[model samples]
Target chain A: MYKNILLAADGSNNALRAANEAIKIASLSNESVIDIVYVADYEKTKEDVLHASSADELMIERRKKIQNVEKALKDNNVSYKVTILHGLPGPEIIKYANERKMDIVVIGSRGLNSLQEMVIGSVSHKVMKRVYCPVLIVK
Target chain B: MQSLKQQWFGNVRGDILSGIVVALALIPEAIAFSIIAGVDPMVGLYASFCVAVIIAFVGGRPGMISAATGAMALLMVPLVRDHGVEYLLAATILTGIIQILFGIFKVAKIMKFIPNAVMIGFVNALAILIFMAQVPHFIGISNMTYVFVAITLVIVYTLPRFVKAIPAPLVALVILTAVAMFSGFELRTIGDLGNITQSLPSFLIPNVPFNFETLQIILPYSLALAIVGLLESLLTAQIVDDMTGTASNKNKEARGQGIANVVTGFFGGMAACAMIGQSVINIKSGGRGRLSSLVAGSFLMFLIIVLGDLVVKIPMSVLVGIMIMVSIGTFDWSSFKYLAKAPRTDAIVMLATVIIVVYTHDLSIGVLAGVLLSAIFFVVKISTLKVERKNSHYIVKGQLFFASTDGFIDYFKSTDINEKEITIDFSNSRIWDDSGVAALSKVKDMLRDEGIEAKVIGLDTSSQKVVQQLDGISSSH
Candidate 1:
């Protein structure tokens, strides 16, 4: 029943699982288009960016992950467009999804334990709480 | 030197005003710290003056203030009590020597390894210590002391809400001191704690006989003083750098502190270091140059010389109130809320550091414990890293560092393999150091020993370069 699907990938295995789930959902509908997004997660990577000698170096590293995600989507024959955003992952993903009016969001759970997930507040949990659309969190 | 002059002389008015404010704050604090160290109040005052003046000229951090601190005071109680002031002076000079060596060795660079949790813990511990130090004055003293302390706290906390022009603590200290003088209560004053010298401090070498026996007596205390002094000074500089959005020359600051201590010792003063409370007060009062520190020292000497009688009469409870306010202001209260939100390991580290520091009254041990625990937790976390094997190809993900080397090898050993050739992909991971390269070598040797040909692929340029360097050297064998 999903028409517009937003898949958030971080190049991790969990994210790859979510991408697969999004592919399956898109394949079920003829008019479905998957918008794949990769958030650079500034809060998590700010130190790396600051320590790196040049912005070009960081961009090149990120491009490799994006290329891998693109290859995966192409191999699955999923009609998709790719976009990269820089900011906190959860809020940025939710904002993009809301602005694009995506019908569903597929995200990966980092599989933190209950205590850790409650304390640190996993990105998926934040997205699930705030996103307007239904969230499919792949563990 | 030209740039140094500019840095020192720039914003002269702000510096002078801030210096005067800091000097005022320093008087009661210096006297109080001297009492804690079991030395005459003049010793702490002279040390405050000498350290302030010398550090102003040579310190790495221009806008920061350094003076006689509670941390250094607490460390000196035994030395002053046993060997007397003469030996304490010798220890102070030696402490300066050791700190100079630390600067020469660039030990200030080690500040990077101190994690955020440890810093928060240090601040909290210091806050608790400062508060606890005031408890003696709170109990068994005149009931008037409590009233004055409450009045001072109210003025310190509420005055800023109405007027932002003056520092609230200074206003509170001045107003409360005057009130206590007029109220004519049987209040303990700075003079009640220790004698205050009105004459200028003169330079003289410590009178202790220089011998192996003397060295043995002073060395341990001197070492403790040196390390604790530098730790407090460097951490204060870091905090000020964050406050003023400027970087400090940590090595220079270390050397400056060393020189200040040596000079203070020669002038019959106790050991001195950075005071975070006074530095915050200076910053909040518009101090922004080396001149402010210069003024703080010169003005303090002037105050003691010219206004010694008036200063001695200021109630101890007034100082107690200001310190209590400092304790309240210095504490990272948000950490309580953060404890529930932060990772359990981090919370544990912070809590453990705070507890140990409070119990042992040793800042270094607490921080060391926190750093050690953080290292252990890091090792545990990285060891959980996994490598997935699929159809003669292995995908390694997660950080590969010294902590994870053995785990990486074990993961390779446990996987069932029958293929003649295998490719290992490292597209999703980073090899952090030489240990990682060594681990890869062991993995290849293990597979070779099993008669399976193995090759690593998908390494990023940096990792590829490391592997190439190692492989080039090994293939020649």
Candidate 2:
């Protein structure tokens, strides 16, 4: 049923699972295009920039995570485009999805552990609450 | 050494100008604080001069000003009221000794434990306390005094918008003081508050008797002063460090403050600490070196010696107006706007801290209460951890720290499966500390006693390493 699928990846096993699910769903349609997005959270990056000596090191670390998702998509032979955005993950993802008129958003249930997710609510939960399109949160 | 000299004198002209600006701002504040502590205005002035000069050389953070602050002044009131300036001097000495000990013990590292909520609460509480201190001058004062205060406030707030080069408070003080003098009103000038000794501060040991009784009297106040002084100083240093994009030696700062206070006490100055408002003013005015602070101290003394008569004639209402502006500027208004949207626990902690601080007039107690409450809330939240049971597997999510260990074990204990092989998945959870390892051991022991086979699985590399080091197991199911 989905045409433009947005897969939000953070390189976690859960995010990989969501990526796999998105790839499977997209395989059924010939015209469907998948966009794998990774949000380098602005606040987290700012904190890392402050605490870490080198900004390049933090950027490299984030690049590694994005590369992992890219490699997974390449290995699966999925035809997809990857975009990395810098901002809060939830709002940025939702905004991008709405602006791009995404048919469905596939995301991991949690990127950080449950305790942190409980304390600062999971990005997926926020995206699910606010996104206009259908959301498939992979556990 | 050459690099150090270059660094120190990098911005000589800018530092000198900023130092002069900071010095001018420091005068009325120092005098007002001395009055607040129930001592001669010279005592506060001398303390400001001594601490500023000393900290300029030895303070951990460069580009930050250290001087007599309202927080330290508030603390000295009870001390000066109960046992006179002699005993207060003794307490000041003792406070310095304790702060030195704190530095040697590396107590500044504990500052990281203080939550953002508590810090915000502290800033707001101090602002409220400062504003309240000015209330007496407004209430029951003469009509002309009221008019002068209004004009002073007006000048303080509006003058800055028009002219950024001149410090608004100094202008307001000068204008209002001249107006009060010309109008021939029976107003309460700085002279009315306390005598301003024209002579420079002299070195003298405190004359309090050194005995057990004296120690008992001064110990509590000294401890309070030492802690409050260090807290404010170190916090202000952190703020300046952030503003300047530089790291400060917090331990060194603590020790420097201790040394400054000790020297201040010996020189007949009341206890002093870092003033955040003045530090910001210094930085905003382009101060970037120790020379700025040194010049600030030297210029303050120069003003006291040369313009002592003019300083004495400044109206108390003008200082009150400046302080009110300081109080308003110090408060974090963002906390109020964010209260509804912030996490409930954080909001409660901040509010509780503000209320307790305002009511008790004790910043330390309020912060302590907030930290205690935050810890309790953390435990309560973590204790709600649950384990989901499936066929031959149990999924453990949430934190596996000390607070949630008992709850985690209890969940597995209630299960009546006997002699069954079970796998526990921990991919969704994390082991924060050694307590988590102990919890895993306890669970394994309990499961062994019930004749059940337990396999722990899905540990991340770090958690796996910790488990391997403790339990001597490498592979998980």
Candidate 3:
């Protein structure tokens, strides 16, 4: 059941907890492997783009962030690889899971509050509402 | 603007399909409603001409068709009944003038008062009323043969989709009228009632029995017109939205309604509103932009002018068939069925409106009753706010939600005492119900007048111990 688990990482602590739990369960099964991924919201605009640093610097920082997670996985003696892509965060994450034939996808529910989720319409809510695959939204 | 220009014209196939359907649809509805308004069927056509034309050009929603509707027709009855057709025509003209004034004053924002439930109630009730009204036309067997009209209704309803481009009403009218005409069926036809004028509607003055008395009498009628007009147009605009995948500013459309009414009145026609049945037919038939509506109005006018005599020859059964179709189209069966299964309050309100409409022969009466009942329901729910009384202390909980706050204050004033010494422990409460706060403030003022110590103990104090402290007064959790 734990084999080929897709860990939806948002560089959040609780997502890390779920990721750690998935890795541990996978290592214990000895047949499971972890696929780490981050989904960027592609609909973000130029004004939004201005708020962030240049692409190369952002990629470098993302790499460092993954390394931190990788170190945590290593400390627990778990095995994994990472991928980063851009699109509507929830759908993209689920699409990646489906495309890669991963068993399950794990995500963090920290980005949006319920009211904002209702209005701006959260990716996780959309995923929960639309996606056929099983998704765990860690609080 | 670019998209508007690109899609504004063309779409001939959709337009023609919708146009023919609307034309067939409008003939019966326009005539029936006109009859209901105590006028010749052609006057209904004249109204269809004026409103459909003006609104087509000026309307915010491109595909929405404005024409005489049963709702407006029903409203016109009393006005026409008491004042006679001439005065009714004057009032109709004035109604349009008032609508135009509404537009010029930019009063479309006022339409927001009509809520979703009420709107749903309106359309659903209207659908029921339409079907009920058509009962006599379908049943060919006279002595109250709206039932045979029902059979013609059934055939028209069931056969239309399978037989494309052939409007159902026309089919029903032709087949049924032929049967009635040739078979010498003891059924009444439009010609039997009175001779429809072969002459086109003569331009008349806006001389609706004008006076303060007339205005006072017709105020509610006009208000009903305004409400029904606003609701139908707004809803039709929504349909147009779904068709074109575009959004319309409803308030703007309402302003357009006001302007259209004013113009229609200026032309000495009856009150007109957005015809949802025709509008839907128009859109689904491929009408886009204002062209279809304009074409429809122009065509209707052309028919009334050139083919008035032939139109008068169309049997009442055929017109009934057309109305039966319109009734089915406007009938919100799904919503009606859903409402039937809804809560007792909802069901009661809907049924009450329906009953009032049937009994009073007034749409406004039904709607007013429905609205009032809805208001009463809100007040009852508001008044039910939990008030825990413990000796000299009181704890108010739940939202002192708006529309309910005044009742809460009144309850305390009537039942409780000690204006100076009373404590309202709201510490356990999570929200300061806006209405509740206003009510509490009012209570505080009243207490001040009586020289009572009115103290608010737990308003917005998020301390968990406040709950325990309040419990000490009642000695219960």
DockQ of 3: 0.03
- DockQ (0 to 1) for model 1: 0.03
Q: Which of candidates 1 and 3 reaches a greater TM-score?
A: 1
Model 2, B340-418: lDDT tens digits are 8768998898899889988987776787898898888877887667788788788988988888888888888787875
Docking class of 3: incorrect
Question: Which pairs clash in the backbone of model 2?
Answer: none
> On residues B300-396, what C-alpha lDDT tens digit does candidate 3 reach at each position?
7776666656565556655665665666556555555546676677667766777777777766667677878877886676456667888778887
lDDT of 1 at A123: 83
Off by over 4 Å in 3: A1-139, B1-7, B10-13, B104-107, B131-151, B178-186, B194-202, B207-220, B266-268, B335-337, B340-344, B387-396, B400-477
Candidate 3 C-alpha error for residue B135, in Å: 5.3
- Model 3 / residue B86 / CA error / Å: 1.1
Q: In angstroms, what RMSD does candidate 1 have relative to the true structure?
A: 12.4
Off by over 4 Å in 1: A1-139, B163-167, B379-384, B389-393, B399-405, B412-423, B430-456, B461-477
- lDDT (tens digit, per residue) of candidate 3 on A1-139: 7677777666667667767666666776777777788654433311122222333454566566566566677787677888876555776776777777777666666653457466566666666665556777766
Minimal lDDT window, size 10, model 1 chain B? B468-477
Q: Tell me the deviation in Å of residue A2 in model 1.
A: 46
Best by lDDT: 2
Q: What is the TM-score of each candidate against the true structure?
A: 0.70, 0.73, 0.63
